[model samples]
Target: MIIVNGDIVAQGSQFGLKDVEVVTATVDLEEVRSYRAAISRGLQAATSDARYQRIQTPFELAPEDDDADIEKRPTLPMQPRMHPVEEEIALSGGCYLWDYLRRSGTAGYLVPLSGGIDSCATAVIVYSMCRIVMDAVEEENQQVIEDVKRLCQYSQGVLPKTPQELCNQIFTTIYMGMKKQSSRDTRQRAKELAEAIGSHHVNLDIDEVYEAQKKLVVNTLNFEPRFEVEGGSNQENLTLQCLQARIRMVTAYEFGQILPTARGRPGGGSLLVLGSANVGESLRGYLTKYDCSSADINPIGSIDKADLKRFIAWAEKEFDLPCLHEFLTAVPTAELEPITENYVQSDEADMGMTYEELTTFGRLRKLNKLGPFAMFQRLVHDWSIDRKHVEGDTAPHYTPAQVAEKVKRFFHFYAINRHKMTTLTPALHCNDYSPDDNRFDLRPFLYPNFWKSWSFKRIDMELKKIEKKRASKGK
Candidate 1:
């Protein structure tokens, strides 16, 4: 049931199957995109309305002492202090999580916290979930109170007094470290955030299990693998990296299946394994297939990296989890490769594209519905030195040739990694554009090698037009 223009309405009620009606209504929610956007519009209107006082608020973003821009503006002095859009971004993710966990019978959530921004964001959402539940309880929301009590297994007089107490009961975090790759810093960071949110934390290295698997693979296959830093081939390096990721995924599930009982909880139920892959990484296919990306649910998956980072900065203050500050500042890495003084793996460097560019690519591809050649044609104008269309574009200015290459490189990797999305965890429908294959963005996973196709030829043809134009001017 949902409110339409302040009136409660039920969808698909004509069907005899009540279950189908509920499933169709809540599942994916693609049919109601306009409705959700309308609600955001309503909030936007509320912020700017003369009657309501402005309040900056997940519920973070510190307010400016002086609204210098507002003060400067003679008109529109009533500009809202809080951005309703960003507030919806954080709240939409948390609200869906609470809805899912509350209705679905589960012990709690199990997050494979890698101590990176993505995972930290996922953990923070759960913390936000706890806060949402408590807020509901404080408002004397009886339905939410019943769900919370049942999920927490609180009986009779026993009840959750705080978000921390509830979080400790439900949320669990695990950090699987490798002997050669994992960092001490990330481990400490994960522990600190878990403590800040009051989650039950587990820290252990998978090196012993990793070594055993390596030994088995070596003995059975009569071959051995090494990392790139160890003078090994590219294939070996990737294999080793994927091995760690795959191991972590399996370990996460093993723990999720048993953590409830292991923690001496009332029930021996399974926990939902939450994925941390953000929208940008999913678009660029930066994650290992069936690694942590393959999970029961992902809250931050549809949201892009840039906004996710902004949300984290906001959450640091809003949730009062200061430990989130480190996550915001720390460089992003898979930590799959062995760490060396000169050679720790960086996610952007490995992808050969920045997260910012990935966001642009994702928007153009999914939202603009642009093909490779069309993307180059469009971006060359926007990202060119002249910045013809995008006056405020922050992207690096590039020549037509360079822009073409970047577009090709992104599409090439995206094509090769498209199969991975088939198994992408069901992420919340929060972003304007999502590459989620399960429901939202549907495209052919298989594509012909467009490198030698008419697309590339068209790109070359377009580049010549620019070069010829420049050459004529010079002459």
Candidate 2:
């Protein structure tokens, strides 16, 4: 007797049913060419939008065009100073933390300074708050206050040390991404900012650890339409995961271990003073879920990226840190990977787009005015459907209700993976809004499901039209 085994799964979903000609027939040479062209157009549009979103320049200004005359134009006072009351409130969070640390009998803050805008701002705030605590303790324990003051004086050199430490770990990454592209000397600039802030500096070389952790992190991502590292492979997924894990581990090491030892304490305070803003929530989420996960307090949690930049500029004038200008001069990057290496593979050498392409489409849909979040959920819904279509198990469409079920399943899969962020603390919990600190609340899951339902309602109508066409053709 002969028996057939169904257990032998093929390496790729698209390649599994090689005997099915229809599945293979989707990619004609012309179709591939058009798809590539559409991708190029889409990329151009998205990047153009991002560039316009960044600058003091108008949307009409060409990115490469010289506007020397515009540079000479008198800069208006775009940001007004905060009211005295508002300023007092603005400075209160740091004060609150300083008192918390003092009462707890902790030695001092162990800041994992990255020397980026957020971390730079954080280190300065911590330094200022310590000063306040020293003042409070001045009359009671002059010796301890003086010790704290002397420590702060020694640590004043640390501000510049933050950038240097960051450089030691990812200087090659910064060079490839920033140095090669522009004449703007970012390292010198970051160094200058560090000096202006009067903080002690230390350089740590974490390259080997980062590389080793990258592999471990990649291996942990079990769910996927996965890719193998190969010739001309962009390694984007690896790059992103590596970047996230490195940030998480580096912050954890600096705060959880080194800081306590440095301060001669068992552990640190309840609040870690995260410097995140709201505008870059998506980017922040990507970075925070990785690097900034170790924080207990996020001072700017409510501020948007736009408002945060405004506040930084305001601080530059108020604090007299000329390095603030230089700090602002450097382009913002998470320092996750080299720029020459495509963060997401733009090459369309294959018939089907890579996983990066799918994710980009999903992300772009979420950002576009046509309803970015809804579009993102819809695309994810379609990825599974497209996979099924390509397998020839189903025609290229599903009912509205069916699509909703698939979206729900996709999210359900991710929810099981929520254990990924469970170890980290969330930054803030607003009275109206839940803290984004990944505290594993039931709410975040609820919105994705709602969006998924909306997506099915919108797309199923179109899919039904496609389905009917196939049904009629069977005659």
Candidate 3:
């Protein structure tokens, strides 16, 4: 909803009729039209009552509201509001990852392209850095250029206009393919962007990789004893199946080694894990235990979803790249699932809470405010914590016994799939807080530890007593 200064205007009001007492000025044209449309559709949803109704003033001489300002106001600040120290630390950590890969004699950064803002930003950053590295190499070694030119020819199976042209073609094809927008426009734009930046992009049909990897994981899960036939385990087992396929540490390891030892150095390329605040936190626990967050490097770990979108906008305009809008507007999904429905945060049938909710409970447990069972259910119930639970009515309460049983159920469901969070190389941590780092280790010892505590028994007994009393009251 748009508000001007102190007055409400343009959007949010659903009723066609405007109240005059609260609104001092005439109803704005946009607001009138929007309200009219809403009323016509018979879906008038008012956010506030008369007490908070906004009054508008005459603004005949006012300048038109700034479109850029409107776009930035609520969204831009969330990005890496990094203090100089924080940025220095983040950049230093990125450099460390690059350096480590270089010393290891690896090549190519492998990032999963989601059409969402995070992946787009990551791609832009990787493309930007790859160009810089190539330029520095070209200045010192003429043969370096020749080798890249030849590699480009071999990879492309066609002659490129220039060394940079080959690089652009490769990057563009790969970028578009990864994002799942293999349309002619996206391909042409990616090529254009790559040419402008002088970077080599390779298209490796990530969908094919996702498919092969997904099948392998599913087959492995189907063999697991714990995943055997059960009533409620169907969805749980499917989620675990995803965990195995999603944990492509081996794939990442190979991609990490793709850069030739003689070409540009390792770590010079980075696998930017495009993650968000929620996923980063949930990953702190054992779910998807080996995938998504398990990356050799994470550039946007500190950036929130809203901020990431803003950065993408900045990058699009600064680089004169196409798809800035398209990338931002695209659905958020890693395409790691076999089914089309398994894509995006809002994919309702995806089944289960996100990594963030699990992480929140883990955090609560770490702080010792509540036991794992209690925290787990609370985490499940806290609609704000998990997007899946958000649309439901108020969450129900669970006693210690109920929570204990639920914990056991969840653990049994998740343990076999813990491989989802595993990774190849440990991440470079700027400090102790990073759960995205490959070095971070979490154990399920907490669940058992809490289960054995006296609190668990006491809660179970109390729940039984309450049940008995309620049953007897019928007499």
Candidate 4:
């Protein structure tokens, strides 16, 4: 019997025999028999125990039924466990970070809160950890209680009373901004979210730091780079942007190491720097290498953009942090580029693909096992009249050529940025199609931007045929 929310629910030991049979079909009959016998012995021991005998069984055999017949009966079809994916992700990521902190003897987590969906999700996951620990303490989980005590450095018999108190102890958020690069709106958002989560928040401007670094580079090279708006070349623009991003990374680590001491705790303890790059951005290679993406651990790295958005929406209600709703309306930006009077930079615009499309491309490339040409072929049908396009076309249809171009462009960037994955922060494995190089994705890092084989040539020919067919239909 199980009690949930004040209601008593009968719980049963149910097994999916069909799933077991599928597994047994791959192994030897003797091995299957041995496995079954081991399970039987374990069950017998459990049933014979006084504790087990006191518990009521969900199903009971009739008095007239023979024990042999009961044993020979097939196992019942078990009910599949259904839980919200968002809740599961929160629990998994929260537990992972909590365990990492406890095992590594780290003080807590330090996040560079950019007021973006990715960073917001990472912060909430840390907040979730506080909630989980509070629940464990309430339930009197001794191991968790001991771990929390040591992690938080609480006195004997003193436990955290609320999630906010635990959060202030464990999580630190820093919004590193440049006057010209980061928006006031985003900075305010980060500040409000930090307050909502009760984290130790710091708002620091790095304009002088950025200028100093730029001057040093200019002095060394005898030249300086500028943004594209300032008449700089693409290389110059990228170099300048990367400088700001790399500097933020450096600053984040410094704070992560000293935050504990700053809070009046003993020296030598450091917080784990958390990364916020999602799987969709990773798949499209839309992030700067060694930037915030190069942190100690990324809680939401394996999650897709859509899922992260959903999680954000869920968090707003679940955590009672309504400030998360701002991210939904806010445009996603790196804020590395110079802010113009009229021009605004967006993540989708920079990547040449929306987060939604990136999620589709990632799923096709990994989960569906589709390469460039195959993906192009499938997407032509999948993203037909009913689907949205990158160009904001709502004409209820996309030509085959448009779909092919989208596919080609996606693969082109995916290959060029494959090397970035080598240095990608270790991310929590939440999705089936994770592009993390450490474990979930094991493809070659060095790949040609475009396929250079006969099969690829054949796919090109097929695409041309498709183009021709579409032209004829138009006529």
Residue 160, candidate 3: C-alpha displacement in angstroms: 17
For candidate 2, report its TM-score.
0.46
Q: Write the per-residue lDDT of candidate 2 for residues 332-408, one digit (tens) a residue.
A: 54543333444422212221322233233334433443243354345545544434445544323544445444444
Candidate 2 global lDDT: 0.41
**TM-scores of all candidate predictions against the true structure:** 0.80, 0.46, 0.43, 0.81
User: Which lDDT tens digits does candidate 1 get at residues 227-345?
Assistant: 88999899999988898899999999999999888766675788999999988787677888999988999998888888888888888887787898899889999999999988999
Local accuracy of candidate 4 as per-residue lDDT tens digits, 139-163? 7777888877776763333677999
Tell me, by TM-score, which candidate is best: 4
Cα lDDT, all candidates = 0.80, 0.41, 0.44, 0.80
Model 1 TM: 0.80
Residues 289-385, candidate 3: write the lDDT tens digits: 4454556456655443444555667657755666566766654444333333332223212424333334433345444456544654454344322
**Model 4 worst lDDT window (10 residues):** 16-25
Off by over 4 Å in 4: 1-80, 154-157, 386-397, 439-443, 451-456
**249 in model 4: Cα distance from truth in Å?**
0.8
Candidate order, TM-score descending: 4, 1, 2, 3
lDDT of 1 at 272: 94
Where does candidate 2 have its weakest 10-residue lDDT segment? 167-176
